[model samples]
Target chain A: MSDPAPQVPPQLAAYRATIDNLDAALIHLLAERFRCTRQVGRLKADLHLPPSDPAREEQQVARLRALAEEAGLDPVFAEKFFTFIVAEVIRHHEAIRDELSE
Target chain B: MSDPAPQVPPQLAAYRATIDNLDAALIHLLAERFRCTRQVGRLKADLHLPPSDPAREEQQVARLRALAEEAGLDPVFAEKFFTFIVAEVIRHHEAIRDELSE
Candidate 1:
């Protein structure tokens, strides 16, 4: 039997490699972003600020959705993706604050 | 000006809708899972357990990677995806413990 056709083009191999590299870079960037978020949590904790800031999260979701659409990604998928990230960040911030207290 | 071609096929529209519904359900399930993780965190905190259980996390990553592969997803992507989720769950658990303390 003949082998199945290739899903991706040979010419696109380089592009696919670039995407993989970018994905790795994105992980590093996300880690850095989490580090900054930890700092923000520290500040918030110091000021006794509430951990869940709905307004700020909404604004962030809107901004990221727009950016993703501009970058030619599905906006709905981007929104869901960032929602998970933001939720995680907020949780991390809360955890940091908890650690600082003890 | 010519209209742009449809990107998704009509037959796939129902499938896409099902995916969207599943996505929403997945969010709900995740939230429920977080709730359970929070309870686990509370128990851990009561028992004076450390938040970072590297061994358990490693096992989780391995198991999920296998499951994702079985589900026909890119194992690497699934690993990264679950890493994010696990991190978030830990953070949430910590947060829940913090709140319980106050």
Candidate 2:
């Protein structure tokens, strides 16, 4: 009798490829979002407004959680994601402020 | 013969608890950092400066990458972490500006 050959599942490979593409798309969208946010920051500077608004951040997190849930994502995970983003925005804002002050 | 009892290593449990505590500290520090950043944002807005500084962001990323490597972390992963944070800061700055405009 001939030895049997090892077989790999094609479906799993296709699913992985699809996930890779989705990840690329996600990164592209995130970049675009950052660009728009930068423009908004410039506008705020022009208008003499502060960078971090707790109330606004709270609203944003709440809204994003709802949107994530609607899109079939875990709300808790979404909240953690937003928390990380919020921390970064505050850091960038501070850097700009320090530069201008100097 | 009696069935053998399942067992979890106490060391593994202790390690997990330590990791959990570290995560909590990381969150707390991040929050404090954001608070400082927000203060910086306000200072910048008062001085009529923009929210996003590409040069500064690049410098910060470079510094962070080096620090991460020194601490036995993957530089690429550290960069991704910083990228996410930068995006959030820009978004928060924009929101602040929009509020002031209104």
Candidate 3:
């Protein structure tokens, strides 16, 4: 990586550093999230359960949207983000199910 | 929220609980991220700097993608997620700049 931008204002640089740290934390959190979901995927595969649960997903969307509002974030944006992550999880679940069946 | 699904396996329920907590944590983290970005936005406005920095954004995407690989997350997905958040931050920055100009 290149050296830090010396020309940037110190306060701005500090904020960017915090943002970068937060972003890294987010990636690690997402990795942990997938690890949990993978276990769930395995459990579902063992139980011969369906890969996707529409009802549960709907409930989670509503719950998260409320939480987003409480956190002063836009509920719609939160829902979109949650949905994106859930889609990835479901894809992994389906892959797991397929592998187990094969 | 509705009572826990009694029919769900305990293992599945536990995983779900962890997932729920992680999801909430993600929301809060995102909020904090925006909080930092907003500060940067205001600082940029105060300094009469531009709202968006394409070069810095490109650097961040590369940096985050590398970090994602280190964290075992899909680098492509991480880039997409980061791009989405940066887009929102830029929008907020633009709004802040507009407000200050007004």
Better of 2 and 3 by DockQ: 3
Q: What value does DockQ give for candidate 1?
A: 0.02
Model 1 chain A worst lDDT run, 10 consecutive residues: A6-15
Q: Report the C-alpha displacement of residue B22, candidate 2, in angstroms.
A: 0.5
**lDDT: worst 10-residue window of model 2 chain B:** B19-28
Compare the candidates by TM-score and give the number of the best one: 3
- Give lDDT tens digits, candidate 2, residues B1-102: 775743424543453354334333334434444544555555456555577768656766676666656654445756886676567667666666666667
Cα displacement (Å) at residue B21, model 3: 1.3
Candidate 3, which segments miss by more than 4 Å at Cα?
Answer: A1-6, B1-6
Q: How much TM-score does chain B earn in each model?
A: 0.79, 0.86, 0.88
Candidate 3 docking classification: medium
Query: Can you give the DockQ of every candidate in the order shown?
Result: 0.02, 0.02, 0.74
Cα lDDT for residue A31, candidate 3: 83
Clashing pairs in 3: none
**Models ranked on lDDT:** 3, 1, 2
Candidate 1's residue-wise lDDT over A31-81, tens digit each? 444445555667667767676677655765676566555554445655767
lDDT of each: 0.56, 0.54, 0.91
Give the least accurate 10-residue stretch of model 3 chain A, judged by summed lDDT: A1-10
